[model samples]
Target chain A: MSARPAAIATLLDLPKPYLLFLGDTREPGYAKTAFGLRDWAPELCIGEFALTEDTVSTGLKRLSPAAAYAQGARAVVIGVANYGGVILPSWLDSLVEALASGLDIISGMHSPLSSVPALREAADRHGRRLIDVRKPPASIPVATGARRTGRRLLTVGTDCALGKKYTALSLTREFAARGVDAEFRATGQTGILIAGRGIPMDAVVADFEAGAAELLSPDAAADHWDIIEGQGSLFHPAFAAVSLGLLHGSQPDIVVVCHQPGRTTMSGLPDYPVPSLEDTIDMTLRLGRRTNPSIRCAGISLNTAHLDEAERRQAFDIAERSLGLPAADPMRPGAALDALVDSCLRAN
Target chain B: MSARPAAIATLLDLPKPYLLFLGDTREPGYAKTAFGLRDWAPELCIGEFALTEDTVSTGLKRLSPAAAYAQGARAVVIGVANYGGVILPSWLDSLVEALASGLDIISGMHSPLSSVPALREAADRHGRRLIDVRKPPASIPVATGARRTGRRLLTVGTDCALGKKYTALSLTREFAARGVDAEFRATGQTGILIAGRGIPMDAVVADFEAGAAELLSPDAAADHWDIIEGQGSLFHPAFAAVSLGLLHGSQPDIVVVCHQPGRTTMSGLPDYPVPSLEDTIDMTLRLGRRTNPSIRCAGISLNTAHLDEAERRQAFDIAERSLGLPAADPMRPGAALDALVDSCLRAN
Candidate 1:
């Protein structure tokens, strides 16, 4: 990571006190960025903006670009990760208005803000910066497979957009609460925006994916824990490479398999069915052993948000009973989460 | 692959015939590009050039830039793939002289020829194109895991820089000789230079690795066989991601495991040992089944260049007996190679 000076300089340099932009998406999954910032870094978020009234909300105050600027927001962050990460033409006027209102625009999309001529012209005329967190570092060395010191807990999933990030973030917090040195390592756009610095795993060149992952979580104290947020899934045909690279490079001592009980099909891919929890844990442990021979599954983090309280309880009960591992939802903090964290910390 | 017009335009459009430039290196392994061209596309190669007189020879007639141009060579291709695919500073003068002598420069190096000021200036002055075949296609889709209609036989290996490409090329030739509809799909710089068209697997964005692989060998006739040249090894910590991605995307029904018997360590990675042939085949088949459920190993392609006639025979015998698969050196064509090809074609 140190080899990339340009990426390092901008890694944690995004303008704060932000206005979140939920770009006309009704699907709450796409607006995970907005909700993530609201939940993780509430102090930095001044307000939220959206194209339509029916769009998903972060439960924050709604403010126009001018109003957000007047309220002391320094930047307007696009808080939506739509399919293909494209900047739609319908959202261009609002982004331009944000620039004219004296706020810079920050994005996590694969398509750069500069690619849109209107946004680029507006930013240029207003002298506002356009930041893209999805851009990878300029230089990344190939992973040497050389082991690094420190304990790491990575959250892998049966499919993409599950609870990997949330699980990692919660575990890191719980570790710190128990007087352990812990760092949350981000590997995607939302996680990077929340953590302020991280390698965009998906954006890196295929050869450098593992190298970038290695740089993302470097060596630290023996007792320190690097809780890494995983990306994609081993069963995910489109992104298995990214997931495998992150898994090998992170070299996690403990892994938490994230799953949503009733996910019949993979996210965004209706053709492929979600793999079973047994297969997920088995594959994760088997592939993970390549880098960390002692790698073990700590537990399962169920995304039971769509289920009722009774269903959530049944899901946890079934998972723990079948896998012989702790099962919990990070969003519902209690003895379950504590047990999951305990199992992770007890591993080493 | 068709979505990337720029890459498609330059895919098989290199100026020919080529004058192979072996930059000062005496290692035959580093000069694979030269040897590959001389062996596979001898008609397209006019002669070989090198900075040092003692450098490894492709056995083609030696020629200077002017001499090569006079003999109807249209381009000077950098025929060496050194550590990191770097263009050495010492080789700049010879490349400049080639451009000055009215020959375009075709490079397969990771470092783009346009990156060097001197080479760029020389090419610009001489109006010669600096084509980098290692550059990936512009637009690649994510792999959908939906099976394409065709038969595929991929050449994987126990380690990098073995005989994956050579085995693949030989198999394609053998299949065609048998009156089968077959094609050689290249994935690396050397293979691309030899095949004249390919997606640079390592150069692709990590998220799109499988996508690029899918595009490279798109749906063909049901009986058509794509002999894909594999990249890194699954046991290779630095490159396992690329290997896995290619495996999943290619979705091959048959795989030929390539290995060098005496190699103790991974290519350029001294810390890691090369996995045994059994482990290599086992892991490859296990992971490859994710996309192609009927995936099976056809044989092992042994790189027995370092061994004498008796040693080579012993190595092949040991490999075949131990793994229960045909083992042969593609360089030493015989019944062994024919058996390997027969096994691959019979897999459908």
Candidate 2:
């Protein structure tokens, strides 16, 4: 839209010390963004802010829009998950007022903030900006299924919010530590912002999702590793289409299964229980191998954030013994990830 | 951009003796449209026209736009296959002249003719309407994984243009003959035009492809079956994303595998050879079972049109023995299809 964004932009360059809107639906997606930003671009992120009528601690200092703007916050970043449906938030009027008061707005919701006529008019009137970070770039062609060069690893998951982005970023860091050239290919908004560039796979035209992947890793050398962040899950009923498209499009030679030890049900579907880790591994292997028969699961990235120290250690042990591959919680320091990187490098 | 269309539109009322544009790219898609129009709406079609400089007999009365308009031709229906690239046809000027001369145009190319500025300007100046039949409708929501009430079946292919639409149509007719209420759910332009209503599944945004399918079959009695037409093959390099999205979105209770006998390469990607029928079946089962573990491949639809009578019979026999399923060419009269319909009906 604006001379086409660079493959990635420097988020830290944006006017920051920002306000993150996490409304009433504060799930792990919201948590991941808050934590990932602090880790990746702490200088830009000021603090967390919620729009709920009742007070809720996000484990960070909270601020109202007016208070945030008064304290050097020039932008508001919305990470709300409940943007679907026609229900507008009670705090929306005040948020629109904040847009009119000259604070730039950034949203990662599927529902574009530009769609709100009142907010659009307010932003225009105030000469402020509204950035829908989830919107994919225009005019990506249908995938040609061109043979991909270089080594690639994709992080898949047993469910949404199961540490796919964290695993990919971790792997990329490990590859970097090993002095191997690697880049984190983000597929969602938070990851995109963290990595400074990647396609919003869910926002793309269905036909071009794979093409976006192909374009992202165009003509890599045999030694380079493109560690791609996968979205959704094969078991995620609401979003498996996105997951499958990314999996096939990325055409990874090696895959890492990211899982949470304490989860029993799918992210949103309570009626649908999460499949066993072995089955998830099996499905990933089966689906990924459709395009690349050489695809193998190099390791497991366990998300033990919700588990205690004892439970977390048990998860790592169970995952390692059952899958017989390197397994570790990506959020914590572990040797399993380093082993995975070594194996993938050796295989390549 | 206008009011949402009904699930199906009655094309019988359109001005008759229509001109069908085959153009130079007469692959399987073109041939299917030509023969399908003859079978479904013969009275509406007057002639076929190709825009090749070389002499090519299309076995129909060749008429120029002015010449066709001199007769009873009131519209031009395009089914060309070479619409992906930026190259316009050599005869495009004359075709636009026809559009300016008041011939309403209908195109099924992935490239939207409306996007061509000159043609759009000409059509606007002349008050002639241009209809892109493959454009997906306005915003469709992400699938809610709603519990569907009626039975549904989807026909997947081993490659593009391998008789997915034909198999679904055949199954719909078989159900009709058995006094069962059923509808053929089209997901592409030709099938949409033939059935009088359906989504252009490939043209949809990636997130909403499955939503389109979910929206197509809202609710029906247990006895009513919705036979859905699938697009692209699971192994197709260029279009597998569409195939996977449709499969997940349709959430079919039963699946049908469509294949072409003696075809060695993918329809477009010659470098990518078609997998063995056994492998295709296994892949379909593996993917489809992700959504519905109860999902079963009910039958196989063989496109033996390229084979002689003896060869066709041999092809069907090989498919039946190898897959252990009833297999037949939908274009030919056979009990295999009837058996499939009966099995699905009984299963429902």
Question: Pick by lDDT: which candidate is best?
Answer: 1
Q: Chain A in model 2: its TM-score?
A: 0.73
Report the lDDT tens digits of candidate 1 across residue range B1-348.
Answer: 111133332233468899999989898999877887998989889999989889899999999999999999999999888776678888999999999999999898767888889999999999988989878867687888889998999989999988888889988888899999998998987787777678889888999988888888888898988999999988888788899899999999999999998999888878778888888888888778888889999998989899999999899889888878888898888998888877777744
Per prediction, the TM-score for chain B is: 0.82, 0.73
**Any runs in candidate 2 off by more than 4 Å, and if so which?**
A1-35, A42-131, A336-345, B1-35, B41-106, B110-131, B335-348
lDDT of 2 at A24: 64
| lDDT, candidates in the order shown | 0.87, 0.74
Off by over 4 Å in 1: A1-32, A46-75, A80-104, A116-128, A268-271, B1-32, B46-75, B80-104, B116-128
lDDT of 2 by residue, B143-204 (tens): 76666778889998888987888888888888888888998888888876666557888777
Candidate 1: deviation at residue A101, Å?
8.7
What CA RMSD would candidate 2 show?
6.7
